[model samples]
Target: MTASRARLAGSTALVTGGSDGVGLEIVRMLADAGADVIMPVRNRAKGEAAIERIRETVRDARIVLHDLDLARLDSVDALTAGLREEAAIDICVLNAGVVLLGDRRRHLTADGFELHFQTNFLGHAALIRGILPLLERSRARVVVQTSIAAARARIDWNDLNGARRYSPYRAYAASKLALSLFGLELARRSGRITVNLSHPGVVPGTAIAAPVRALLPQDLVNWAVHRVGNAPATAAQTAFDAATSEADAPVMFAPSGPFGLWGAPVPRAPFRRFLDADAAARVWREVDRLLS
Candidate 1:
């Protein structure tokens, strides 16, 4: 039963940030299920190495890489050009992101926008917009990797690009928060494709844990965190579920453990408060204005 559910057989998927950690795990699982995986990577050599690793174990893992620097909208454009030239995509996973420690200094993206907001959310949003025709062509499912941090943020139209002020962590968290809000709203606006937001519990060994560990004094604090945290491979299972499962769910899946902190893809609806149709509309309007 599980094998059948895992089977992609001939479907095509694009996994951004498929080079390492949680993203690598996801690519492996998808390839094992017979997906022709498209990896849009910042570094081509690193992506080749990751594909080799997957092929070593999964054999015949259909994986291809397209040079994509999500930080650059132009790169995003090039990636779509290459992908459209290939075949229709069945799944587009917006998984690549970075959390630069701007302890006291502010950084910017190639487009001159706040680094985190531009890369983490806006870049992917542009990717989605650019690929809309392809998505419609393939009837694709879009998966946005949102984080638990989103629960701590609300859409801020006034300073979305952090024109007024910026804190590295706030910028990172806000970017992720904005993605979730957009994912929910995007789904509400366009029902032609299924758009889902997911939180892959506390996978402590992953880069997401790096920010938290940076502030800790002891190395043990970091080691202990990964030891007790969710496994990277397991953390991606929910993403796999969202991309493949035919479950009829109204809300996105927040796959964590019993406490919503660690584990597999357990069924979940996002907070009911987030379900307010009006709020979802407002999110769409504000983000559209900010990015426009």
Candidate 2:
């Protein structure tokens, strides 16, 4: 086994959204690297298929699936409770997310929050809170998947739920920005756990690119994706590197290609907003209050 993979022989990783896209790729990489992987899925059939696919490449891959729906806090709580029984969790990748470009109308979760805000940011926030003890005990490497969209978005303090004015892209970007801020704050607050951020450079087949695919001609979209965007597996490398890195200082791993869209994963400076300590603290407080 490679040196990196060998280092993870006895490690355990919990990955959210591991049933598909870049999340699935991260799970496969962890399993191949000799880490036991636990994936929380919203669908049993899909989760089983993902495990089957992983076992195809690693005959003795150790993987477990738990039911989770990031849109619902109760589901997040159940998964966290089950995971608390584990001995240790060495790595946690908060990667599950949703983009609602397909539907322009505003949607709310059962918790009565904006769909994107709750699923992408708030739910993950709640999960982190629930598992903070495990993470601290294990000194786990926690990697949060963020997006380039976060750089361009700003939180609407007055309308966090987008109840006043709504747009698909705005809601999605805001959620990512909030998530990014939370990651930064977590890094500052937890000296025991190593917290890092990752941006899976644009990958066309992923949900984030669904709108682009629908609007462009098939051939053109394919060409653009090949020329400028990464494939899911390629994009996943950023998060994988962040999760396994020995760096004590927090860093944001992102693509090194042109316009930061495609290429090898490398450490990059976080966007200015991501470094706003005041903003990060505010986000943490707001999420805590909302979850409580």
Candidate 3:
């Protein structure tokens, strides 16, 4: 094993969305590094399948699966409650998300929030809050998987739920922006644990890109994605780096390739908009109020 992987031999990691795509790749890397991996998935079968796949390479891989639906606060709470009893959690990768590309209709979760906003941002905020104590105690590295879309998106404070106006891509971008802001703010507020943001670049075959299949010819899009986009394993490097690095402060990692599309992971500055302290604090307060 590489030195970095060897360092993680006795650590524990919690990863979300580990069933497939970039998430599955991240989980495999963690398991291969000898960390005890805990994956909270929305689908049990998929989670089991992911574990089986991981063990194919890391024959003695230690992995546990739990149920979690980011759209439901109750589910998030349940997972958090169980995790709190654990002795140590060295890493937490907030990576699960939903992206609706061509769909025009706005959907709400059972919690009555916009699907993207809830799944991508609010639920993660709640999970972070719920596990704050454990994180603090372990001094864990919390890696938040953000997106390139966040660079151009602006959060509509008035229409956070998309009740006033909505578009699939807009909603997705806004949710990512909110998540970016919250992650930045969390980094500032919590000195006990490290918080890092990772932009995995455009990974084409992943579920997040599935929506775009409806907008264009699937074959053409697939061809383009394969031609220009990074594969799931390649895209997962940014988050993997963030989770394992010993950076003391919050660092944003992204692809070093052109336009931040596909390349090796490197430390990059966050989007100019994400640097707004007031906006980050505002988002933090709003999430707290909503969760309360």
Name the top TM-score candidate: 2
Over all chains combined, what TM-score does candidate 1 have?
0.90
lDDT of each: 0.77, 0.91, 0.89
Provide the lDDT at 36 for model 2.
92
For candidate 2, write residues 69-170 as lDDT tens digits.
Answer: 999999999988988899999999999999989899999999999999999999999998998999999999999899999998989999998988999899
Show model 2 residue runs off by greater than 4 Å. 1-4
Please give the distance, in angstroms, between residue 176's alpha carbon in candidate 2 and its true position after superposition.
0.7
Q: For candidate 2, what is the lDDT?
A: 0.91
Residue lDDT tens for model 1, 1-292? 1366457888999898899988998899889888889998999999999999888878878898889887888898887776667668888888888877535577777788787887888888878877777887787788888777666666556777777777777788888877766676777666567776667877777776776776777777757666566787887887887787675343456555665777667768775545667766776676567557
Q: Which ten residues in a row have the lowest lDDT in candidate 2?
A: 1-10
* Candidate with best lDDT: 2
Off by over 4 Å in 1: 1-6, 215-219, 222-227, 286-292
User: Can you write out model 3's per-residue Cα lDDT over 1-292, one digit (the tens) per residue?
Assistant: 3455666899999998889999999988888788899999999998999889888877878899999999999999999999889999989999999987757899999999999999999999999999999988999899989988888998888888889898888899899899889988988998888889999988878766776666788789968677877888888889889998888978888989899988888999888889899999999999989999
> Which one wins by lDDT: 1 or 2?
2
